[model samples]
Target: MGMRLWKDMQQIVGAGFTHDTGLPTWFEVAKATFLQETYQKWLLYKDDCVKMIETELVPQGGLFCNRTFDRYACWPDTPADSMVNISCPFYLPWFDKVSQGVVRRSCGPTGIWDEDDNGQVWRDKSQCEDELEVTAQELWLKQLMVSFRMLYTIGYSLSLSTLTMALIILLSFRKLHCTRNYIHANFFLSFILRAVSVIVKDTMLERHWGREIVKHSDVSDMLSHQAAIGCRIAQVMMQYCVLANHHWCFGEALYLYYVLIASVFIDNNKLLPYICVGWGMPVLFVVPWVVMKLLKENKECWAFNENMNYWWIIRCPILFASLINFMIFLRVIKVILSKLRASSNQRGYPDYKLRLAKATLTLIPLFGIHELIFIFATDEQTTGLLRYIKVFFTLFLNSFQGFIVAVLYCYANKEVRSELKRKSHNWRTEAVLMCCGQ
Candidate 1:
């Protein structure tokens, strides 16, 4: 009699499982077994059947067992079989009510349990998958942290050195504040901003200090959003400033060649505006693009894709600027060689020939090859490794620019060296007096 009642319940549930169409063999058997057990439990405790299934059986035993069975027994190709075993048990009326209530309260009306006419829930599966993938990739961020630390160290050190060298030169040799030094001062200013950006972005991403600050702050969300916006602006400005420095360097080299080789001279005061244009144009071009991107793209962080067209917009100008600088370097070389040949013929000895050759060789490692690395390495779709390499090289190369320029143009001249030494001694004496007074 009991077996007959269980079979009757199975027939009812089995009919529901198979609509007008057919059902899979495995799904039919699983549905029959589930209905038979549910009917037996219902008979034993009629009022407590729903409570037992909802609280203890379905939540603990039914869901857990169904999940395990589906994982191992379900055919990979049969979506119907998989769905029946994994999903149908959750629709047992009581479980459905509890699940719906909990989901509605936590996720609102458009919650996970909200089903369409086809009885399929409209959940954002892609969002869940993306979160899972990001969590998995968190381990790789350690490497990025290391790279960021290295870049910050190199950039900060180089920027400070460049600024110190420039300040010393400006104060000690006031007479040497010509067109070149003026342009260099602007470059140093930009480098300072770049250094600050690097340190801020690196610290935020790697150190978790922002997270700690947010824990303690009252208006954490507003502060974080502002910081994010500021960081993005800083990054874009830094890159534009770098390009501006390259442009100014190219212009300086052109001016030098025009004066020395082409016998063309322009007044220093008249050339100041052109110098300003070299630095100013890049900022103008980059600011609009950044503003538009900020309006459209994600605002939670500063990253490469903030301006998707950054490479396309900036590449042409940078390449053109690099080419112009290379042309100036070639002209300088040609002029030096011509002078050396003339000197050697007149004196029957190598006068400026060895010195010029040595200077050119030294510059190959300093300016020529260093800039070439940047030109060659800057691809539109740079990967993390490539980005790291580019930043590392930029920091390493530019860090030495001020030192090399000081050595070649300043120390090489006896007058500038004498003035630098005298200024260094005076600075040291003043520093000692201040410390002693304190």
Candidate 2:
């Protein structure tokens, strides 16, 4: 049994041993003695080893077993690797919630302590120092934030490209410059800017990828300090664009309602007021928000405040716009149905209603109705499947807002399609004429 134990121990540590393998430490002898229960004894020895690592491995001491022992101080097996509160003795300030001063070094597959890139065994002190990686939930949340940013980056890029094309198409055609199209164009422009701002914000936050927390009392403060002025500008622009997007959609709904339901006093051609409300009104909300945040919070940037009352500067306007637009939508539907019924064309009502439904669905992103659903979409009570569903669904809908707007308003618009066809036909005709002349 003794010979077998010796051979087994030799096999495990032999490759790392030097010519001067020296006598085994008391910890190693303890480990060798309880060979039948090597696992438990090693764990106890590991704990004891740490307790006396400085004394045991001193040059004058006789505890050295092998050169491998020089690098690795033995550590006990943790019940859960993820929950281990790893600390570093080299650093000061006892990390909060670490439960005493010691760090949790991982017990590796070889039943030895993990080593650093330099071959020096060390615990990941960052895991304790950085609060972001402290808990499983927090780590997952951090990853989810990254995923959200990635999703937003891709989605908004598509939206930005499409929106720019949409603007070009609208501006290229003078005929499509009526109140509704103008409002749509304004909405597109707002979202385009919003997309750009969000992209910039994400870029500035790229350093947070490695689980390092950006320390600040607030997100606005973090942005202001960590990032350049462009980040703050982008954050402010996002706020303005978000508000402009909402207001412009409201303007669109109102214009549609006036044209369809109450057009007697409404001059469709005089849309300067609508344009002002769409483009200019957002400044009212954004300026005060910036000023207040600067004065009161010394915020991270012009980022959203957690308080609903504080956010009331932007939220109240957006919410009011959404409510008003929804009301206009319902009123428009009622008027359309009534007109059709009075004309004795009940058969056409279903098709008209279906079209209206599609129109309403498309407008949901524009008017910010989808945002209301997000209020209840928090992962507070969620776990596992539900949490994933809530996060993914929210991200898909929220991040892809600009894409959805582009698809519905620009790519799918009848006027845009007709304009494209007309341009293509004229181009072909000009080409043919030039060929004939040649």
Candidate 3:
């Protein structure tokens, strides 16, 4: 099939050559010829099928009476007609079947057709008898969809929740809203923007609006490309925000470690500069990339060219950032361990709780490790289970970070724990008061 397609492509190109442009002209001519030929063939096929049904199979009583025959005849006609008009026959058969009311029943109360009798003909209960028993390929696709949904939902929820929490803490608990929380608040704002962008992109893709917008546009192709480039710039900014936030977390950890272990040697005030650098560096890295993207023709936002050496643009900083985070984490661990050892003579060790905290800290590196797997596995060449695994792990791990931080830090911190307890007590007290009044 591949070789035949290649030969057909070559023949198409060979037939369209002009004297002036030579090979390049021939290539362009060939591409146009191939598209035209393909379209014509699709139209011919549809016409043949439609002619067959209308002439041979259509009942004299009309198509609507006998549901079975009517469905059979109408199925091919609808798709065939649509394909003929659109000049895209690839989806004709599928759409025809779907449009003809050949629904696959489900096992639900509506018997898979639903209350409105609107059943999806693509994959019915028979094909996917037991969803759990689905083929690995099917499961992988389903899992990918699930992962996408999970990331979209979790990212959006966390962005909103975190931002709200940060704002409340900053405004209400002013004394508790220190530098780290201030940085976190700004990061959450950026995260909210990122989440909104993701939701918009996903919604557009789901509705096919993105493609429709392009198809229906009257703008020149070059102008369309320029607009795409601008969107890409915005996308890079979102990525920068995420990376910078991770770096900021590392800086926070480092500052905390220094204050605990090296307070006598280092000025605590100096840590503020490190925090500023962590946040500012990502902007510096992204500005040039955004400018270059604006100047370049936009083809795709995420697809990378094998011939282009753009991998380093993301990989280098990610590697450096991850390394720095690891180093900071290690420093914290070393200091904590040293303090625990030195204070052995003071009182009870709090061994169990301390062990648990250390274990949690150790798990932080897993985030970066899984992210690396995601980075390497998501390339043009990746396929099958590996690709799905990478996607699932990446989405799950990245999202898990926010939850982990919330659980470990918020639960462990005396102040946050107290605040949450107080809030819960207040809610209960309000409920009791309302009941008594009633």
Which lDDT value does model 3 have at 247?
Answer: 64
Candidate that scores best on TM-score: 2
List model 2 lDDT by residue over 47-166, tens digit each.
555666555443542322222222212332333222244233221222254334454455454445555686645455343332323568756754665575567567777888888988
Q: Which stretches in model 2 have alpha-carbon errors above 4 Å?
A: 1-99, 102-147, 207-230, 302-308, 340-356, 375-394
The local lDDT score (0 to 100) that residue 44 gets in candidate 2 is: 54
- Candidate 2 clashing pairs? 219-300, 220-299, 220-300, 220-301, 221-299, 221-300
TM-score of each candidate structure, all chains considered together: 0.56, 0.62, 0.56
Each candidate's root-mean-square deviation in Å?
A: 17.8, 15.2, 15.3
Query: Local distance difference test, per candidate?
Result: 0.49, 0.58, 0.47
Shift in Å, residue 47, candidate 2: 33
Q: Best by lDDT, which number?
A: 2
Local lDDT at 423 for model 2:
88
Total backbone collisions for each predicted model: 0, 6, 1
Selected candidate, larger TM-score, 1 vs 3: 3
Comparing 2 with 3 on lDDT, the higher-scoring candidate is 2
